[model samples]
Target: MTKPAVDLIIVGSIGIDDIETPAEKREGLLGGSVSYACAAASFFSHTGMVGVVGTDFPQEFRDTWSSMNIDLEGLQTVEGKTFSWGGKYHDNMDSRDTLFTDLGVFETFSPELPENYKEAPYLFLGNIHPALQLHVLEQVREPKFVLIDTMDLWINIAKEDLEKVISKCTMLTLNEYEAQLFTGEHSLTKAAKKLFDLGTEYVLIKKGGNGSMLFTKEDTFLLHAYPLDHFKDPTGAGDTFAGGLMGALCASGKTDKESIRQAMVYGSITASFGVEEFSLERLTKLDRDQIEIRVAEFKDMCKI
Candidate 1:
């Protein structure tokens, strides 16, 4: 079969997440790197997913992605148990305590890109094994831009391998803490310098609620978060932000710094919706008009 082309290819984790909020315990649902990426990207482009799940992964979830027009041809369903995670959010909601992780089929999984997927112009490599992200990058025959997201866990445990992947990506996105840890610098400017020196042209440091900063060797841009009155869940805000940011970039048909900056604005707006409703509920319901309204509001709020 000749598969249709896509605007973006997302490579990362896909698993079942058991979430606990202060009010209740939520049973397993679909989640992980590519899940958030797929959800956000599906809104703006022809998106495809690549990840490993196990036999226990729901068929309905697969059907949902197909229904939404996301290509899941690269999704691998293995013989063992599905990847599972259990975590409880603290009272503050910004932090969480991980209770369990059974890697299941993901432990020894390897990504095999579909024949046609190798030509995607843009790629988002969600947080996963550093070595694996690099492997995917190595296989891309014509990638125009590659964005990578990583965590403190990998920076702390696999620094060298992580460095290799960081050096290869066009842009690297991380939270404030992870950026500081990666560079051993307390100041965000200094940390970004270190990252830019590592061969990444753009380094985005995300400060929760305080907003995000984008830095290059010669330029720096700061974006304020769109304020919200009610906060429900933050489990996937960063991933949602990436989705909005990158998805918009794909929509813009450009890869310059200004396009990336606009992407950040869209990302922050998308994340505001993400925190309002749990999982993908809020994001899924938001259409282009709704997002444009929020983007205008965000721009006005950030005005000098």
Candidate 2:
């Protein structure tokens, strides 16, 4: 099959992840942004990645993306060590504590888009420096749809830069807490409205167990979380959601309200799988059929 002209380009954090669970503590695969985003996006469409990794970043780790058919041409390997993070998850599995962060090459990272990736139709700007997100946007020659995610860190320290990035994106996805932090408001509705005013036509607020909400100037769609018996890992779940949601949108070849709704279901289904196991094990094991089955189940729950 002929290669797609890079359906989606993901720009965000990339590094080594060290995870700890109550039942088991391991220092294996973990990080943020690009890792989770690219892992999920690889499932539905062709994807390219942009992030910084240290020389110490394992070959096996980098090879995983290529093995999954994701293009990592934009991944930069610096002279120093790869970014490493250690975190411990509570029994609840929904929250975690950061034990350590070694920025390595990611500390002074600067993104430069690849030749073939500059014109991607779909773009995902993972949580990073908001200024960096805008830098990526400036590099994109023509992106039909751009989805950007942010965190409370930038909301507190780089609010202005965050707004600048939000002003350019077509869609913005953040957790309820981040929304509140960004807008300096406790009300989610008000926070989303503020975000809409910033520039995004659509906004998605992710709530841990309570479910996720999608808002646009025209309407609102709420997606109930798929009740799971147990969750082994919550790490990178939101980024995974953004990846799957945007992946489905890119795959559907539509940008309507209905398509965004469908993409939310796709995101929830994909994230449900992410929490079932650590890292990409559950995600990698799923084929298109299995994903469709879960997505259909989510639709049934939504009465879609």
Candidate 3:
């Protein structure tokens, strides 16, 4: 397959987040699924983001993403305030409470891909309404691989639409709870199989601190989460992970099993950095050398 101009195209939310962790509280930080994912993916390839932001979106935020080498052609600037989310993480960082969510411009978001982005070989459909995800799928050209991310909200309220979205994607990424919710199966293995039966070629079940599991018809791979002594924020880790996975794949220009495994490692490594600081602070300061060194350390730690 010929490579498209853009290595990866991501469609999802773009907004500011108000986060309160056990250690600190910060308001109005640049966030959203597209923000985190594009940041991670930018490390490995030419990445572009498609999302809507309101007039209130900061100019600095736009410049930051531009500096990251992300194309913002598909990022629409509309009126009103950008979407905002507020959440507080517990001491353990395992559970969080939603303080408030103001959808704002995101509530009316309708993705419209730029002409140049329509043929991108790799596409990541971020967690959004199932109908919106489906709309994106229809707009894109024949993507070499399509990955979809989902949260529990869509599972409970839009199972049928979510199922339709699942059937169209090449892979699905969701937390373990979402896996069980979708299949009504307690077993991860069973849940994965059920997802594959739904037409997705692969299923990735994220276990948060424990790790992640990748399931395909012929194989199952389990990876441990990269260890961190202190975690400042857990928000957007999943989106960061997804970005790394897709970024690595785009960089390698391969979708083989070995490539996928390496992508998972990259994903875990990126996520470890995400939780070390709030929002994009750590990620923005990171360089390729830091990421490679950490990935090597991870390989050594996992080596038997």
Give the best candidate by lDDT: 3
- Decreasing TM-score order of the candidates: 3, 2, 1
- lDDT score of residue 243 within candidate 2: 92
* Model 2 CA lDDT for position 30: 53
Sliding window of 10 residues with minimal summed lDDT for model 2: 1-10
Ranking by lDDT: 3, 1, 2
* Candidate 2: C-alpha lDDT: 0.85
Q: What is the TM-score of each predicted model, taking all chains together?
A: 0.95, 0.96, 0.98
lDDT of 3 at 55: 95
Least accurate 10 contiguous residues by lDDT in model 3:
1-10
User: How many clashes show up in model 2?
Assistant: 2
lDDT of 2 at 86: 90
Residue pairs of candidate 2 with colliding backbone atoms: 17-30, 54-82
lDDT, residue 122, model 2: 94
Structural RMSD, model 1: 1.9
Error of 2 at 117 (Å): 0.6
Of 2 and 3, which scores higher on lDDT?
A: 3
lDDT for 36 (candidate 2): 82
